[model samples]
Structure formats: C-alpha cells, structure tokens
Target: MGRDFEAADHSAALIEQVQEAIAARTTLRIRGADTKAALGRPIEGRTLDTRAHRGIVSYDPTELVVTARAGTTLAQLEAALDAAGQMLPCEPPAYGGQATVGGMVAAGLSGARRPWAGAVRDFVLGCRVVTGHGKHLRFGGEVMKNVAGYDVSRLLAGSFGSLGLITEVSLKVLPKPRAALDTALEMPAQDMPCKLRQWRDAGLPITGACHVDGILHLRLEGGEGSIRTAQAVLGGERGDGAFWVALREATLPFFNDRRALWRISAALSAPLAPLPGQALLDWGGAQRWLKTDASVETVREIAERLDGHATCFTAGVADEPFHPLPDGLLRIHRQLKAQLDPHGIFNPGRLYAAI
Candidate 1:
C-alpha cells in the first residue's frame, strides 16, 4: 500500500508495458506521479508508472485542439497553450508540478472557470487507451462533433484509470481572453445565493464569481468596452482589489486544512452548516471545499437532503466517499465493468470497494 509507483516514459511503450503487465497478472497501481494517488484506496500492487508517456503528439491552434501523451504535465501543457494564446477552458489545477493530463481527467478536478466554460469531459474529443485485458483500443476521434456512436473518450474522463490506461488524449482548447478584470464587494454571507441568482439571470457573461468571508469577488473578461458596460450595470456592488483567482484556486488560508477534504456539489442556496473545521465556497456557491472530521454518512445525508452529493477529495478510509448507486445503477456499473474488464486487473475498487 506504499506509494511505490514507476513511470513509463513513452506513450507506445506505456501501452505495451501495461498490456504485458496485465497478461502477466501483475497488479499495478497506475499513476502519473503521486499528486492524485491519495484519491483512491491504496492498492496492494506494484506501481505502473505512466509518466514516461510524455510530450504533445500534435497541436493545431487553428483547429483549437491539442493531442498529447497522457503523462504530459499540466504545467507543460499550459505553457504550450499560453504561447499559442489559448488555454484549456476546463482550467484544471496543476496541484503541485506532478499532476499530468491523465491524472486531471481521472481525478476530474476543474477550476472556477468550469461552470463558465465546461467540464474536462466536454472538451475530450478522442483518446487511445490500453484496456485491462492487455488490449489497445482507440475511442472517439480527433473531430469534435463526431458523436457517431457512444462517447467513450468522454466517459474515460473521471473514470480514474479504473477502465483503462489512457495513452493519448485529444482535447478542445479555447482562446485566451483579450482583457481581464476582477472586482470584489463586501456582501453578507446570507445574500450570496440571491446575488448569484440575480447576476446569472442578468447574462453578464461574468467569467467567475465566488463569496468568501464577507466579500464577493467577481471576474469579468472579453472586450474592454463590454467589461466596462458590465461594471456600470453591476452598479455600486463592485470594488477593486483582491486575488479572487488565487482564492478560487484554493490557495488561501481557508484551504490550508490538513484534515479530510470533502468536495460537496450542491444547490447554490444550500445552507452552510457547521463542520469540525473551516470550508471555502466557490463556483457560485455550487462547490464547497470543507476541511472537517465529519463522518461520510453525516455529510452525505446533508448533501442528499439538498439534492446533491459529496465526494472525499482527500481522506483516509470511508464507507462511501462518493454518492452510492441505486440498485438499477449499481447493476449497470457492474455490467459495464464486466464488459470492459472481466478480470478487474485495473484499479480494482477505485470508485467503490464492492465493485
């Protein structure tokens, strides 16, 4: 159960290596580095390092799509994208220098811009993956609107490498904004829901907005004239100053907790309840990062009541860190797992233990 993982430095080599390992009945704790290793249960297997599958396969700025080996670091990708005046709309967090493209899709960690732009899965056009039974298969393709069949590439996102080892990924990139400005206002915590609803209903095209402490920070982008118009329409609710992005990035004191980190995706109006420790609100009140000692059941019950779910972003052991599946859904998951990996040579019991 130690964090003893290895790296396969090349895309083709990693795929072949994974296939060979599966044929040999080798239990591999597949990983890019160790950034997201704490996400799932520490497997009782030797590590399969895919970090060696690095570098971009292709990048077409005119087409707004980039294909890169799964193990390419997010930092490297971002720098490349910046040079081309483009970025991943998903705004994935680097979370240390080790988080790779594969880990980002598997972990499904999107930043504040997620709601404004789209999720990681939304941009996944295609991928080449090595399945559990030592088979290399290509899912989807390089085209965006090619939904001619099941969207396997998108499904691979958030699958946590439990289904397959992603060798290469094709993602849709977005143009960088021409102008950007941030505004903060002193707003009451209780007024956040109403403010968010009003602002969203207004169609202001605000890039990001979040309430922390007693201040509400909002980000605006696009043409300078349009941003100015937005600021005028926003009225006296705007004040200059504060790094909302860093706070949204969860680098502030509120996120420095060393306890179990639970990410609760619930209604914007979900009443903030007291936990063992502090928490940070983001994504217009929908996403909450809590540092607490509350039992999974306790947190899950609260989320369930509010028509949402809670996942343990960081934790030790829990009964159910993710939202449990009903009988019907559980049956479907089992069927799919059987179809893709009958032997379960992949990350066994990743999303759930019984599976």
Candidate 2:
C-alpha cells in the first residue's frame, strides 16, 4: 500500500510539472541521464529530469517480458535480466553508467548483434507516456499479440522525446545463447563485404561482424556444435569477446580519431568505392562508419548513390543529423506530433526544426 501511495504521488508530481509547463506555454527538455545529449539538434528549455522516477516495475523470465520505469538505468535492467539467464536481444549500448531504459529507447541505438538479433524498437512491447496536455496514457501491452491499432508504443522508440515523455516501457526479452565464439581473419577492407554476404547466405549463426584496421572480426552465438562448425568453415584465430564490446561502445582505437564521424546505412551487398577517410564496417556491411573531414554534400551524395542514407552520427556537421524525410512522411510526422503535443511544449526542434 505504501509503494502504491509513493507511485501515485510520483505520477501526480510529474503531471503537475507538465500541466504547469503547458499552461505557461513553456517548452521542456525531457531528460533521462542525458547520456545522449550529443545526438540530434540541440535544444534549450526547462529541464524535466526523470532520473528520480526509477525502478523496475515487473519481470517475468518465463514470459520474457520486463517492464520498468523510464528512469531505471540500463545497468539495473540488464543485471536483472542477466540473473534470469535472459537478455535484451537488441543489445543496446550503455553510452555511460547513467544510461537509462527511456534514453535507450528514445535514442534507438543498437549494438553489434543488431542485424541478427533485432533493433531496440523491435523488443519494445508497450509504453506509458505523459503527453503535452498532461494526460497520462498507456499504449501497447505486455503481450506481443495485443496489436490493435497504431503502434504508438514502438513509435516512441527513437523519437528522442519529441512526441511526449515516455514514463515507462515494456520490452520483450530473449534467453541467452547456449554457446558463443569470437574469431578474426585478416582481409582487405573491400573484400570483407563479399565474404560477409557469402557467410550469411551459408546460414551460419553470426551475431556480430566488423572489419576494422585490416582485420575482419566475427562473433558467433548458438549451440556449441554450430560454433565449432562455423569456426572451422570461417578459418580464423580466436578473438576476445571484449573486442566486440569495445566496438559496440565505441571505445576501440579505430573510434579514437577526432575527425567527423558519419554513419552510413547501405545494402549488404553494396559495392565499396574508396571514400576519403578511414572506414569501419559493421552490421554485415549494412552499417558503415566513416571518419573523415569530407564535405557533408560529398559524404551524403556518395551514400545516396549507393542507395543508402548517411547521418552525421557524432558531430554537428549537418543541419539535420538524420536523413531528410519526403513530403508524405514529413506530413505524417507533423500530424503525430500535433496530436500528441498540440501545445508543442515537448522537446521542440530536437528532431526537426518545423516540429
């Protein structure tokens, strides 16, 4: 009963804050640890800290679902999942120790196993949010088959607080793999993509793949027998699992350079024409990270020509860090933003200037 009372009081406080902001026509920057402050266009407003509203609401290993408050740290959630021998399949990055569940979903950043496992949004089942009008609403459910209407829960993923304040999230979890192995092979940067394609077609259990500094690193996770067979077929010396973790966290030497970093998402079989800087390949050639001083137009043009989009992932080089949307998509975004935040008191101009 005391716990329920505390939760009710917290909710009332949050609603009051939102109502005051709305009444005053004051914009608010919803913050959860601020680990991803460097991402997207910068915004300035009254800081609405969600850190104090932290806790794991529920977890059922058998059901493979864990619901937690927005301010709950990723470390806490992962620890609980680990204890249950299950995991967040998306393998989100904890940019810092303060990384929160809300921030993870909002940023929508995935890790090395993304292509094989899934994305952050894929694991999201439902969420509770406070919209601009200070109305508390819940969209989605703990079960996967509860699909009824618009997937507003998943839509909050990667929204970066533009639409509303995500107060809680429900995520689908997966069991840990029975076995895992890491292997590396020396290969030319250009040849790595084709090799990755061949391995993928061969139906090997590849959870992660990256080519950096003239070395191709592959991570395989599954049964022990499959791991041995894949190692034999791939033919590379064993590598450290920490290597992949560093790669995912951007702590590797390859990511140490201070040049402008651009994340390019292209086809798995996309041909590689030598670009003007150091390159690191991940996502089985679908995601490429380039560190270069090249012009924004040059980088984007090359990516567009390859039938992919490039974003200024780390720095403030472009006016829009994300790919520009067409008129049709932009209209949908505007409509949704207006519906959820009619007064536009949420994180305004964080995603796009017009919204």
Candidate 3:
C-alpha cells in the first residue's frame, strides 16, 4: 500500500518550454491528454504535454479539499475522493475517462448537477501555472481566501489553455449526498421548464433536471427522508441514474448523430426556439444541446434572440466555436493575453482567431 502520492514537479520543464518558445518567437500549445482538443479552435504550436507531471499532491478529506498536478486524470482524482466519500461537485466530464485534471478545469464544462452543485470554476480554489513569460507562479491557496489582485486560478477554468500552462490545481470538494433518487416523468416538453422552476423555488432536493424526448428526467439528493418526500411529491417512474453519466460524458444516443451540435446557455425558462434539427434540454432548460444541420449564423442568431449565446461543438462548422465577444470584451481578452503571454506563445488562436 505504498504507492507514491508525490508527483514529480515538471514545472521547470514546462517553464523551459515556454521560455524557449518565447525566445524563438514561436507558439506553445499547452495540452493535457488533448481530450478536449475538438472543443476549441485549432492552434499550431509545439505541444507542451503535461501528462509527465502527474499525481495527487495533497488531499484532506476533513477539509474537503484536494490538490493535484494537472496531468493527473480526473478518474485518478475521483478514485481518491471516492475512497473518502467526497466528490468534485462540478461533475466535470471525462470523455472515455481520458480527461485530465488540467483539461477538466481548462474545458470547464459541467454536468446536470452543475445547476445545483456549482460549476468547475466555482470549485476551483487555486492553481500553479506557467505563464507566457516562461515564469512559474502560484495563485490563490489551499483554502478559499481573498485575492487582492487577479483571480487567475479560477480564470483558467474554461480558458481552453489559451492563458497558460496549468501545472497544478487545488479544488474544493464535498461529501457525497446521504441519499439520491432518479426519476423521469412523461410531460409536454414546454411544461418541463416551468415545473422545474416551481420545484426549485419550493426548495426541493432537486439536483439534476433535464427534458429530452418528452421525458422530464430528475435527480433528487440530500437525506433519505428528503429524497423520498420529493419523489412522492414529484411522482415519476424510477429512472436510470446512469443516464446522467452518459449525458455528462456525451455518450448518450442523442449525441451519437454526426450532425453539428450547438450548446445554448439561456435562462431556465428559455424557449427551445426553432432548431434546424432536434433539441435536448438539460439543467431544466438552462442548457439546450441541439443537433442541427444549420449554418453557424442561424444557430447563434436563435440563441441571441433568446438572450443567450450558442457554441458550436462540431469543429469546421464554425470559424469560432465560441460566440463572438463585443469589441470591448475582445480588447480586454487581448490585453489579458498580452499581459500573461505577452508574445502570444501560449495556444495562439485557441480561444479566438483575433486574440
């Protein structure tokens, strides 16, 4: 039982790569397993693989915190947490279970429980990163605390590795719920959102909610009494709890289609709006995944009208996977990019071509 928990510190090696790229005026593509490769815009550069630096640095089950090197796979971290009966509340996806800890924070996509539990960024406590300047720096700490300046740690979340190389991260965790229940009710698609809102406002133990193919899928968490009470009130047939995992990992039959996929983030009550293909509602309509053959403009325009924005998950379907930012926001992103990776040596064009 003497497996090594101490990970080799490869920050020096990563920092060296950044320094070399900076001196040569070339770019560096920060990567961890490359599992989220298709999730962002393409960039050309020498790959800075983080997998060589892997291990759980420190874990405190009593404090509900775990810090691990970026190269450590989510499954690895989850195994440790599972042993302690704790979990990463964000429920980040690990497609084919190859997603690494760095990639999880970089991609920043969460599962159905995200609405109730919080997001990947929300659980991020701190991180150690190698900036474009070829310097190693640590931000935040093991515990949640006030950050006087930049919250660069959490900012790395969903950054697609454009910011810098995230070598390690400290994340807040939570004990598993005492009891959980999964159920599904057949209902009109349009009514699902409203009902979910009602339940949320009433403070039910509702943790996961989705409506796909006229079935409102639900997950209840908390004590046994609370789940049982909610289940009785909601009155739905028992559902396969594994369904949530499938959706989280993008393994559901709904995602098997070759059609381009659009992720629409809108208010919980946002309408499905017209789609070129079909839509699956998750997070109780806060998120809508559409399988469509429509043009990028059509998909984004629909999301805009709903006061939301759309991101294309299918590469080559859109020049920019993420929705375009306003001129001012774009400028700020460029500024931050310059400040961190002044030479633009880190994952150039990974987030946007303009940046």
Identify the leading candidate in terms of TM-score. 3
Ranking by lDDT: 3, 2, 1
lDDT of 2 by residue, 1-355 (tens): 0121222225567778999999999999989888888778888889998877777888888899998888888888887888879998898888655799889999899998999889999999999999987899999999987576679999999899999998889999999999998999999988876787798788789999888888989999999999888988988889779888798678889788899888998876678777789999898778889999998888988888778988887747889877777789989999999999999988898888877
Least well predicted 10-residue stretch by lDDT in candidate 2: 1-10
lDDT of 1 at 235: 55
TM-score attained by model 3: 0.97
> Residue 33's C-alpha lDDT in candidate 2?
87
Better of 1 and 2 by lDDT: 2
User: Of the candidates numbered 1 and 3, which has the greater lDDT value?
Assistant: 3
Give the number of colliding residue pairs in candidate 2. Answer: 0
Ranking by TM-score: 3, 2, 1
Residue 280 in candidate 2 has what lDDT?
90
Q: How do all models score by TM-score?
A: 0.90, 0.95, 0.97
